[model samples]
Target chain A: MDQFTLNLIVVGATFALYFGIAIWARAGSTAEFYAAGGGVHPIANGMATGADWMSAASFISMAGIIAFGGYDTSAYLMGWTGGYVLLAMLLAPYLRKFGKFTVPEFVGDRFYSGTARVIAVICLLIISITYVIGQMSGVGVAFSRFLEVSNDTGLYIGAAVVFAYAVLGGMKGITYTQVAQYVVLIIAYTIPAIFISLNLTGNPIPGLGLFSNDTASGVPLLTTLNGMLADLGFASYTEQHDTTLNMFLFTMSLMIGTAGLPHVIVRFFTVPKVADARSSAGWALVFIALLYLTAPAVGAMARINLINTMYPNGVKETPVARADVPDWVANWEKTGLLKFDDKNGDGLINYTSSAETNELDVNKDIIVLANPEIAQLPSWVIALVAAGGLAAALSTAAGLLMAISSAVSHDLIKGQLNPGISEKGELLAARVSMAVAIGVATWLGLNPPGFAAQTVALAFGLAASSIFPVLMMGIFSKRINSKGAISGMLVGLIFTVVYIFLHKGWFFIASTASYSDSAPMLFGIKSTAIGSIGALLNFAVAFIVSNATEDTPAEVQELVESIRIPKGAGAATGH
Target chain B: MADKSSSNAYWKANIRAIQIFLVIWFVCSFGFGILLRPMLAGIKIGGTDLGFWFAQQGSILVFLVIIFAYAAKMNKLDREHGVEE
Candidate 1:
């Protein structure tokens, strides 16, 4: 069969499975809709969280970034995975024990102020919306490439499919579907990796294969790669190029942001017990690591393969003829992502950093998607990768939409605006909110600001600066007053957003950015690394305000004490 | 009164475990993976140095172990303090 037909069959089958699970696990009540009836097993919840956490960026873009950026991108790997440690240790168990429905609800109740909750709702919406836009565009790109449709049409189909499952199942339906997605995505990611690993290193395991000697060269893969890159005037693969300070700050921002993301935080609320919440984070990381550990190996090996294919006679020798460029380059050229220009009219492809002589410009996003094709892998493997990318995009989109809907229906409307709203009314509101959110996300996805992974990083930075500090203070420090929390959140949110807008353009208009991501750093920190500094400012401001004004109320102090002790953590229950 | 003291003790034990694990967490990712990476440059693993391994693979593996360790140890403490749910 043709590659397109095989992709359609595999992708169509996966969508059918998701829809079937959605109908079977359809949520019936407010409890079911908001928290999956709070009955999910620890392991099952962990699997779902894994799907929620690993978005399209992880599946499609991360390896590509690592492939080109070399050691500098290790910050992403460490930053993302290291975050669950902070979450499991500091946040998950305590939040689960609080036994509330949404994050804003905890903030409102813990601080004894409705205003605090409203601010939290605003933060949740901002972060979740920004995060969802990336997923939406990811869905569009996956569909466009695999199904041979326009990007906009692919986006609409992706949005409609997500709407069906998310609206029907709520958290309940989404959870089970996410578990299935985790399985599909992990298999899709690992299979091609194993094949490519064996081809390059004679080892079946990709993770170990990364360290093994290359079969063709009989030298360590990294040693060969570093030598080849240096010969071509590129940086060494094994060395760090980013400033250490920037790497530390960027990694810290991602860690805090991961812990603070509302979608992932809400998943813990579904587990049966606080202990389960703790264990669930561990299991989730284990599942996530299955992909992460393989990513570097996949990236390094893919780079080697591409380099070898391009320079069959080696880089020090003559350049390959333009007419001889492979099908993969031609396939990507149509999308304008991969460009080749014979500047000297020599009709040969020369890839180098030098602007005057460079002949090919490869978009970083294309590397992972084109890897299987570059290696001459079978059609089924390519088809599976398409299905996996869609699964990653859709699962994360569903999780983000769930967070947005719950924040609207449960936190905003029911909690503050209409305290007398009926349970049935709230459930209806949640579904309607989800539909509207998907619509807006799809519209914005048609013209995304940056690549899927870069836009997703902005969401993390926003979360790191705003939501994380407030949530951490609410649980860890009893002395922090509502006034302090509010001030800290506003300051952090505003400062971080302004910094990003200045560099990323006001609302990402591209023409408006005064500075690029590199150079003119704030104290030698890039915009991405500024989130950690914003978090620090938040903590400092919150503490200064709390000490200068009033301490936490007496009853609130007792609430803090109760959350600290985990004795009475009943099995998960809806509010 | 006795029950109150025991619960307080349990909370303290929980906090202590978190503290210990967090220290380990920082050491693995931020320490060995980033700051102390240059120091470990002398120790080669496979094709790269020890620091590169920590950054990509070692830290994540350690993070997994830390969480499970915290969970198991905390549950044991909970049972010991008569606070298990």
Candidate 2:
């Protein structure tokens, strides 16, 4: 059978599985719609969170980013995973005990302020919407490449699939479907890494293979890679190039941001108990670590493979003739993601760090998707990658959509707009809002904003600076009044947005930026790393404002005390 | 139900434990991985040093252990405080 048939069959089979899970898990009530009826097993919730957390970026682009950035990019690895530590210890258990349908519900009730909730809803919407656009675009890219369709058609199909599951089943359906997605994405990610690891280091476990000896060079894999990169005028693979302060602050920002993300935090509310929330976080990390641990190995090995492919004999020897290049090169070249130019008219492709002399131009994003082909793996594996990328994108898009809809239907419409709305009416509203969210995400994805590439910084910066600090202060300190919470969130939100806009363009218009990232304005900290400072400002402002104001209400103090204990979580409270 | 005093103690104990674990978390990821990396570069692992290992794989593994261990300890504390459901 042809590759296209195999691609269709594999991708079709996965879609069928997701649809089956969605059909089986149709939600009937608001509780089921928002928090999976408040009875999800810890391990299942963990798996679902893993799938939700690891987006198309993690599956498709992370290894490539690490591959090219080398040691300077360890921030991505540590920052992403280390946040679960913050979640497990500082936030998850307490939030689970609070037992609310949405993050804004918790914020509103905890602070005893509608304004606080509204601010949270706004922050959640901005963060989730910006994040979801990337996932939608990823879905489009995967579909266009594998199914041979236009990007718009791919996005529409992706939006339709997400709409069907997310609207019909809500969080319950998304939770189960995400579990299946986790399995598909992890297996698809690991198999190629395992094959490559064995080929490179004679070790089957990719994580261990990274530290093991290179089978060809009889040295540590990293050592061999570092040597080759240095010889090619590239920075050493294992040496740090970025400043220490920026790395520290960047990692801190990502950690807090991960914990603050409403989509991730809401996953904890699905578990039955607070203790489950804690262990479930551990389980989620274990699953996430499975992919993360393999990523560096895949990255280092891919760099080596690319170098070897370019210099068939050795780096010092004659480069391969352009006409004699591998079929994988030709295949990828058609997509415009990889290009070969005979710069000196010698017809030999020169891959190097020097821009002027380089004859091969490669997009780092293609590293993971093209790995199997580059390594000469079978067509079935390539097809599985296509399915895996879709699963990663769809699962995250669904999770973000759930967060968006719940904030609108539960927090905004039910909590504020119409407190008397019936549960059935609320459910209908949730479905409608979910469909609308998906539609908006698809449209934004089709016509991605100028700042689409920097959405990560924006989403993380907002979450870290605004949402996380407020949530932490809400749970950890009873002195903080509604006024303090509102001001802190606004201050953090405004500071972060302005800082990012100043560096990235005013409202990301590209021409209105007051400063450039190459030369940052404050303490040598780039805008992406400014969230840590912004979070500090939030905490400080909250402390001062709350101290200056009257103490929290006695009832609100009791509410805070109640969330501290895990004894009476009961069922998640609805409006 | 536990009295208010003992419940407050349970909360205090939880805070203390979280503080200790967070210190360890900070040390592993930020300290060993970044700030103190140059100081610890003398200790080699594979082709890199202890700091690089911490930045890449070691700190992640430590994070896993810290989370599970904290959970177990918190669960036991919950039971001891008579707060477990």
Candidate 3:
């Protein structure tokens, strides 16, 4: 069958499988809807968390980012994983012990004020919705490319499939479906990487292959990559190209952001006990590490392969003719991910830097998606990648939708607005909220306010500044009070938001509006890296605010004390 | 019993352990790879400096060690607290 047809069949079958599972495992209780009855085994919950955490960026864009950005981008590899340690130590077990239905619900109760809950809910909504739109866009992009449909048509199809899987099953269905997605995404990511790894370094493992020698050049792949990149007017591939301070801050930002994300935190709630919460995080890291560890290898090898393809005579050979370029080029060209203008009209594709800062601005998004084709791999592999990209996007979008809906129903509508709402009524409200969220996400994806990468970074920034500090202090320190938490989040949130807006926009300041991400950040720290600084400010502010105000209430002090110890954890569930 | 108590006390001593390891991890990844990189510019490792190693591989390896250590230590703490499952 044709590659497009094969893609439709494979992706379609996977969706059908997920849809079937959703139908078979439809939730029957409010408990099941929110936390999958809190009965999920640690391993199952871990796998589900992996699927939720990976998202479209991890599956589709990460390797590409690593490929082009080189060693400097290892921040992504480490920062994303490193946050789990923080989550495990300072956040997860305590939250599990507090054991509420939602993150904002815990915030509302712990702070003992509806205002705190409402503020927390707004933050949750902003972060979750922004993150979800990118996932929707990924779904549309993948579908249009592999299924030969228009982008809008593909988005609607993706939305419908996700609705079928998520609305009926809620948390229960989404969890298992995510577990399946993790398996699919990992397989799709790895198979191509393994093939490319063996071809380049004569090594089977992509992670190790990065450090091993390139058989073609008889030099280590990283060393060869660095040399080739430097020759092309780019920074050395394995060198510290960016400022060390910014790199440190950026990595720290992403780590805290990972810990604070509501959707990721909610996944831990589905597991049974405090220990399960801890173990599940460990397992989630194990599963997530599989992708993260492979990513650098994939990026390095892909970079090497792309260079080899363009410079058949090793940086001196004439590039292949644009028109007669291979079928792989033709296929990706349709997706607008790979293009050729023949600026010099010599017909030979001049893929080199223009010798004056490379006016060729290739979007980094296409790197991982186009990896197989760059290496001249088969059509089926390309189609499978398309499916994998959809799996990543759809899985994350579903989880974000759950967080949003829960915020609306559990935190806003029922918890504060109508405390006496019946379980049946609450469940209905959740479904409606989910439907509305999906509609908004779909619309936003179609018209994306900014680039997908920028939007994801903003989501991380907001979470890092606003949510991480509150959650950590809520668990680790008994001194922090409502006033402290609120003031801290406000200061951190405003600082990070204003900094990002100063660079990104007044509100996601656009590049077209005479702003730049490279605008002189404080201490030469870029706007993106300042999120971690914002988090530190948040912690400091919380402490200062608490001491300046009244001591925490006796009940609140007792609550904090109890959450620290492991016993009575399951019973501490404020059911 | 002595061995178990020693392990338990080691586990309970949290500030020192987390502080020591986190400092090392931070120094390797953020400090060496990023901050002091200019200072370590001439110290080469496979055609690059120690800073470059931290950015690409050294920092990541250290992060892995930190997490595994944390997990191991926490597990021991649980047993000592008589909270082992």
Candidate 4:
């Protein structure tokens, strides 16, 4: 079968599986809808959370980023996964003990202020919306590439499929579907990686193969790759180009940001026991690390393979004839993801990037999504990759939509708008909220405020500064009263957003954004590294504000201590 | 009552253990990978400096080990604390 047909079959079957699970596992009660009835097995919840957390960035963009950015891109790998450690150690267990349905619920109850709740809700909405935009666009990209539809048309189909499961199944249904999605994505991701690894290094395990010697030339694969990339004027695949300070701070920001993200944090609430929350986080990281470990391998190997295909004999050799170019080049060229221009009117495909030498400019996002075709792998593998990308996007989108819907229905309409609401009425409200969330996400996916997916990093930065701080203070420090929490969040939220907007538009940093990261970062801090500093500012302001305010009530003080000690912690469900 | 006291002691000890492990985490990732990277810059690994490995793969692998070890040890701690469910 051709790549398109194979992708259609694989992606079609994956969606059919998710939709079927949604039908079979439709949530019956608000509790089930919201928390998966608080009884998910620890390992199962871990897998689902892994699926939710990875998203389009992890599945599609990461390998591509590393392939091109070389070792400097390790910031992404370490920063993202290292954050899981912080999550498991610092935040997850405590939040699970709080036993709330939503991150905002914990915020409201712990701070004893509706203002704190509202701030958290705003942060959650911003994070979820920005995050979802990427997922929807990813869905669209995958569909357009594999299913022969336009990007917008692909988004509409993706939105429809997402609505089918998210509205009907709620968290309960979403959890199981996400777990299934995780399996599909990992299988799809690892299969091509294994093949490429064996072909390159004669090592079956891509993770180990990255460090091992190249069987063909008896040199370390990374060593060979770095030399070749440098010869072409690109940074070596293993060489560090970023300043140490920036790398450290960037990784720290991602770690704190990951720990603070409300969507990932809320997953712990679904498990039955405090221990389960702890163990679940560990399991989630294990699953996530499976791909994270292999990403560098794939990135390095793909860079090598791409250079080889372009040069044919070796990177030092003359370029290959376009008309006689390999079949893989033609396949990806049709998708417009892979391309070569004979800038000097030479029939050969030039693969260098210096001012003097002609070069082919490849989109960084295509390195992973277009990998199988680029390597001339089997059509089935190409199809599997398409399905995997969709799974990554859909699973994350479902989670984000659930967060948005529950915030509106459970927190806004049910909790505050009408506490006297009947169960039947609330269920309807949840469905309505879910529908609205998906609609808004889909619309934004089309005419994005900017680079739809890139806004995702800003969402993390905002979460790092605003919501995470308030949640930590509320649960861990009773002295941090409602007044302190609210003020601190306001300050953090304002400063972080302003910093990003000045660089990005007030909304997003499209290709047209005035201030690039290369532009003067505040105090020499890269935009990506700004969140950790914002977090510090948040902590400082909270402490100062709390000290200025009156003492906490005796009962609230006791509540904080109890949560701290993890005594009387209740079982939570993953919906 | 004695068992509860013993369990509390176990939990305290486990916290101390986690603290020690976290220090190592910082030293490898934050220290060798960043602040002290210059100190290790002269020492190379596979053509790149020693600091680079810690920044990328070494720190992350260590982090994974720390978490998994903590989970297993913490489970034991919980069992000894009489808190395991």
Candidate 5:
């Protein structure tokens, strides 16, 4: 059979599986809609969280970023996974114990303030919406490439699929579907890495393969890669080029941000016990680590493969004739992700670090998607990759949609707008909000703003700077009153947003920025790394405001004390 | 359920444990993986040094261990404090 048929069959099969799970797991109540009826097994919840957490960026773009960025991008690996540490220790268990349903519910109840809850709802909306746009766009890209459709058509299909599952089944359906997605995405991710690793280093395990000898050169894979890159005027593969402070802060931001993200935190609420919440985080990391560990190896190997393919004989030898370029290059060039201009009219493809002399311009996003094709992997494997990418995008989109809709329906509409709304009415509201959220995400994906690229940093920054600190302070400090929480969130939100806008154009409009990232306004700290500073400011501000204001209510103090321990958690369920 | 003082002690113990683990977490990722990396460059691993290993793989593995260890310890604390559900 042809590749297109295989692609359709594999992708279709995965969709069928997801739809089946969604039908089997349709949510019957608000409790199930919001927290999977608070009875999810720890391991299953962990798997669902893994799928929820690893977005299209993790599946399609992260390895590519690591491949090109080399050691500098380790921040993403450590930052993303390390946040689970913070979640497991500092956030997850306590939240699970305190949990009724949504994150804003905690903020509202813990602070004893409607304003704080509304602020949290706003922050949750901004973060989830911005984050979901990227996932929607990723779905479009995957569909366009594999299914041979326009980007718009791809996005619409993706939106429809997400709408069907998310709106119908809510968290329960999303949870089970996410488990299947985790399996698909991980298998799809690791199988290619395994094959590539064995080919490059004679090791089947890609993580260890990275440290093993390259089969061709009889030296460490990284060593060979570094030597080749250096010979080609590129930085060493294993050496750090970015500044220590920026890398440190960026990692810190991602860690906190990951811990703060509403969707990820809400996953813990699904588990039956606070103890399960803690261990579930560990299991989530184990599942996430499966992909994270394999990523660096895939990145390094793909880089080596690219150079080898281009050089054929060696880096010092004649480059491949333009006419003789690999079929993978042609295939990717058609997608406009890989370009060759044959500079100097020499008809030779010169892949190098020097910009002026380079004849190939490969988008970093294509590295993983094109890896199988580049290495001449079978058609079925490539088709599986397409399905995997879609699963990654769809699962994350569903999770983010869940967070968005719950914030609107549960936190905003039910909590504030109409406290008297019945459970059935609330469920209807949740589905409507979910559908609306997906529609907005689809529209944004179709007409992605110029800042679409910066949304990851923005989402992470807002979460790290605003949501995370407040949640932590809410749990860890009873002295913090509602006033303190509100002010801290606002200050952090404004500071991080302004800092980012100044560097990335005011509101992401190119002409309005007074400062550029190349010459940052403060201490050479890139806007991306400023979230940690914002977090610190938030912590400091909260302490100051709380000390100056009235102390927390006695009953609120009791609530804080209750969440710290893991007892009577079952009694804490549902409003 | 335990009385307030006993619960307070459990909370205190939990805080102490968290402090210790967070210190380890910071040391592994930010210290060995970044700032202290130059100091650990003398110790070689594969083609790169130990610091590179920490940045890429070692720190993640350490994070995994820390989380699971914390969970186990916290579970024990929960049971000892008579707080386990």
Candidate 6:
């Protein structure tokens, strides 16, 4: 069968599986809807969190980012994975012990303020909504490339698919579906890596294959990669290009942001026990590491493969004629993601990072999606990749949609505005909020703020600056009053948003920024890395404000004490 | 009975464990991976420097070990303090 037909079949099969799980595990109560009745096994929850956490950016674009950025991109790997250490040890168990349905509930009850709850709900919405936009656009890109649909139609379809399952299943449905997604995505990701690895290095394991000798070049993969990069006037693959300070802060921000993201944190609540929450984080990291470990290898190998394909006779030889450019380049050219210009009128491709001599301007997003095709892998593997991309985008979109809707319904409406609302009423509100959130996200996806990975990084920045510090202080410091927590969140959120807007454009409007990351940075910190500074400011503001205000009530201190001990942890079903 | 003083001790012990693990986490990802990467450049692992390996793979491996260790150790601590759920 044709490749498109095969892709449809595989992607369709996965969707059918998700919908089936959604139907089977339809949520019956608020407990089931919010926390999957807290009955999920540690391993199962781990797998689900893996799928939930590894969003479209991780699956579709991360390797591509690493491929181009080289060692500078390691921040993403270390930052994201290391955050789970923070989660497992610092946050997850205590939050699970708090035994609430939503993150805002914990924030509000712990702070003993309705205003804090509302603020927490707003912050959750912002983070989740910003996050889901990336997922929606990711689905759009995957569909536009694979299924041959327009970006708009693809986004709508993705939103609809997520709405059907997420609204029907809630956390219970999302939990099982995410587990299935993890399996499908991991298989899809690793298979292509394995094939390419074997073809390039004669090693089956991509991670091991990365360090092994390149059979084609008769040298270490990294050595060959650096040599080729030098020949093309690009930075060496092993060398760091980004400023050390920016890299440090960016990595730190991403780490804290990963811990702060509401969707990932909410997944811990689905487990059966506080102990389960701890172990589940470990298991989740194990599952995540399978992909994270493979990513660097995939990035390094794909970079080498692309260069090899371009310079078939080696970097010293004349470049391939523009007419002889591969079919993958031709296909990507139609999408405007791959542009070739014979600047010197040589009619030959001289691919270089230098603007003057550069022939190919390749969008980083295309590297992973087109890697299989570029490597001449079989049609089935290509189809499975399409399925995997959809699984990653859809599963993350579902998770974020759940978080957004719950914050609106459970935290805002039920917890604040209409405390007397019945469970059925709240569930209806949840579904309504999901539909609305998906609609907003779909519209934004149609006009995406930036590349999937870059857009997601902005969401990470917001989470890092705002949510993480407040949550940490709430659990760890009994002295922090509601005023302090609220002030900290506001300061962090405003500072991060303004800093990002200054560089990325005012609310992502193009060409609005006066200064770039290249020079005139705030303390030599790029906007992407500024979130760490904001987080520190948050901590400072909170402490200063807390000390000036009235001390915490004795009862609230007791509540903090109870959470820390983790004894007499109540059921997730309990209010 | 879970007295206030005993619970306080348990919390302090847990804090100590957290502090220790966080130090390792910081050293692996930030220290080895970024700031001190230049210092570790001489040490080679596989095809790359120690810093690159740590940044890409080693830090993640260490994170896994930390989480599991914290969980197991804390669970044991909980039992010892009669705070086990």
**Candidate No. with top DockQ:** 5
Which stretches in model 4 have alpha-carbon errors above 4 Å? A355-357, A509-515, A573-575, B1-18, B38-50, B79-85
Q: State the DockQ of every prediction.
A: 0.74, 0.82, 0.29, 0.43, 0.85, 0.78
| Deviation of model 2 at A518, angstroms | 1.8
Instruction: State the weakest 10-residue window (summed lDDT) of model 3 chain A.
Output: A353-362
Docking quality of model 2: it rates as high
Positional deviation of residue A531's Cα in model 5 after best superposition, in angstroms = 0.4
Instruction: Provide backbone clash counts, one per model.
Output: 0, 0, 3, 11, 0, 0
The local distance difference test score of each candidate is 0.88, 0.92, 0.79, 0.81, 0.92, 0.88
Q: Which is better, 3 or 6, measured by TM-score?
A: 6
How much is the lDDT of residue A407 in candidate 1?
94
What TM-score does the A-chain of candidate 4 achieve?
Answer: 0.96
Residue A102 of candidate 2: its Cα lDDT? 91
Q: How would you encode candidate 1's per-residue C-alpha lDDT over A1-575 as one tens digit per residue?
A: 99999999999999999989988999999888888988999999999999999998899888988998888899999999999998998999899888888999989988888999999898889788888888888888888898999999999889888888899999999999999999999999998899899999999999999999989889998898998898888888889888999999999999999999999999999988888989999999999999999999989998888788678799898878888878887898988888988899988888776899888887877777887888788999899989999999899999999999999999888888887888889889999999999888888898775644455557888789888898889888999999898889888888888888777778777798888787634766888888898899889998999889998888998888777767687655545
lDDT of 4 by residue, A288-346 (tens): 88898888888888888888878778878887888887776676678777767677888
Tens digits of per-residue lDDT, candidate 5, A1-575, equal: 99999999999999999889888999999999999999899999999999999999999999999999999999999999999999999999999989788899999999999999999999999999999989999999999999999999999989888888888899999999999999999988988899999999999999999999998989999999999998899998888888888899999999999999999999999998899999999999999999999999999999999999899999999988889978888999999998898779988999888889999998999988988888789999999999999999999999999999999999989999999999899999999999999889999999998789897899999999999999999999999999899999999999999999998888788898998878889877899999999999999999999999999999999999999988888823557
Error of 1 at A420 (Å): 0.5
List candidate 2 segments past 4 Å from native: none
- Native-to-model Cα distance after best TM-score fit, residue A268 in candidate 4, in Å: 0.8
lDDT of each residue in B28-48, candidate 4, tens digit only: 878877778779989866556
Error of 1 at A450 (Å): 6.3
- DockQ score of candidate 2? 0.82
TM-score of chain B of 1: 0.94
Give TM-score, chain B, model 6.
0.95
In candidate 3, what are the lDDT values of residues A463-557, reduced to their tens digit? 99989989888876778899999988888889988887777767654753344656555777877788898888889999999999988888987
Output the TM-score of candidate 1.
0.97
lDDT of 5 at A215: 89
Question: What's the TM-score of chain B for every model shown?
Answer: 0.94, 0.96, 0.73, 0.83, 0.96, 0.95
TM-score of chain A of each: 0.97, 0.99, 0.96, 0.96, 0.99, 0.97
Considering summed lDDT, which 10 consecutive residues are worst modelled in model 1 chain A?
A448-457
